[model samples]
Target: MDETDQAIVRLLQADGRLGHREIAEIVGLSRSAAAGRINRLIESGQVIVRGVVHPAVLDRNSLAHVGLVVRGPAEPVAALIAAREDCPFVSLTSGPHAIVAELRTSSAHELDEALSGLRGLDGVQGVETLSYIEVLRDVVGPVGETDHRIDDVDAALLHVLQSDGRASYVDLAAHVRLTPAGVRRRVLRLLDAGVVRIGALVRQPGRDGQAAMGIGLRVSGDPRDLLEQLGALPQASFLARTLGRYDLILTLRAYDPAEMLHGLEQVRGLDGVTETVSWTHLRVVKETYAFEGLAP
Candidate 1:
């Protein structure tokens, strides 16, 4: 990605629903040029734009990371796991574990059902599940409670954006029976209210030697203080406090293997971090942030 590409990405990460005109103004590009770059980014499979609902919407939602030790080929196994609706992220890893899957379910029962199906898959030897009790930070936005309530019209707009964050205002207006101006206003309001976050979900290619690691940290100090420190790290994408073998979990992505190692070292060198475990991703099968299915 070039500097302009990076700028466009940052803007979208801040608010995915930004129009081409708005993006162009910030990036100092013509409207068409900005649109072209964004299209290229999306077409190249480097970025995915979508509306991600905050976890607060679903009271009983259960999100977990499952480590699988497969007996045979990991590619096919990862592909199979990626086919399921609940398994948004499935990757073959290069640690003691052969595969890692990020599963999301609306309830505990649904989570159990998904886990059972995963266990039944052939070549799967074992499954180690880590449930996230509180997600301190996610891909595009922080996970927390929502103060504003969404009406049916608001829900419709969000539902559409959940599928396509760059959907045109005219199209959305048609869907919600509002003028183009009305649709734009509503979307801006939703973003300002923190009811939803629109941003790119980047899935870097593992074959290119980009470093992707899952680090579990065991801290010895106050949880809040430790969490604050971890959250500021550049490479950390998904960080959360859990209730299992590890006190915290982090998903890190780097441009190269060296940078990845550097990030790992930085985390280990933190003051309160007592111990750490790392897993390298060999292949990322799926990366999605759409929350349409969980929308209220």
Candidate 2:
């Protein structure tokens, strides 16, 4: 995690399929050296490159944020929720809610069942849910419709990419029985249509004194202007309008406590903001964008 490593990560975050030579050109290193560093980073479990299927493709349109109040240890409850396929983001925080998780499902009924399952778990005292009305910003990439229909070959490619986003076109061709050129075309089509995004998922926050916080805001007037303002901030990672105790929710990542406070204060100064509540993430039990199954 030196400056060069950080630069390489930024490149991968933009496009995980970047070749070592390309990365080396930008980072000012030999191709083999760049490749060595990237391999070490992945081997160390610091960064994972994968294809993140859009919710539209999987029919996981129903998305919600659930905060749990546990009677006993929160780690066990968090671990239990993390094991569920639908829950992608889960963390233990320092706030009234001991654990917070995000659920993505195909329908509202499934969402209810998932919540009920959570409530039935031992040590679960209460559950607070925030259903997303509209996602303004996503951590993966721009949200788009499922313009390209997924056939068997496409499905195979997606599944492989989920495991290894930087899989060579020749390797992908062998998997799907298509020519390398054809495989490349199909992969590009998926990326262009936004059906899938190829990027790096940081398993842990950067070791450079970085910290993250979740902020819930209650806004008054037209939120459109406010959203535009908040969305432009560099620290704002995720943003959404939701149906719950809070009108808007977002996650901010900063280098230190003072920087986090500054970001929060900036949000408070926004015109339409009425009140705000926040919690520092004590531990991120799980944060993954990859899904298990892709329907054909």
lDDT of 1: 0.80
lDDT of each: 0.80, 0.85
Q: How close is candidate 2 to the true structure, as a TM-score?
A: 0.92
In the range 7-44, model 2's lDDT, one tens digit per residue, is 88778877999999999999999999999999998989
RMSD of each: 2.7, 2.1
User: Per-residue CA lDDT of candidate 1, range 162-221, in tens?
Assistant: 778888899999988899999889988888787788887666755433467898888887
TM-scores, all models, native as reference? 0.87, 0.92
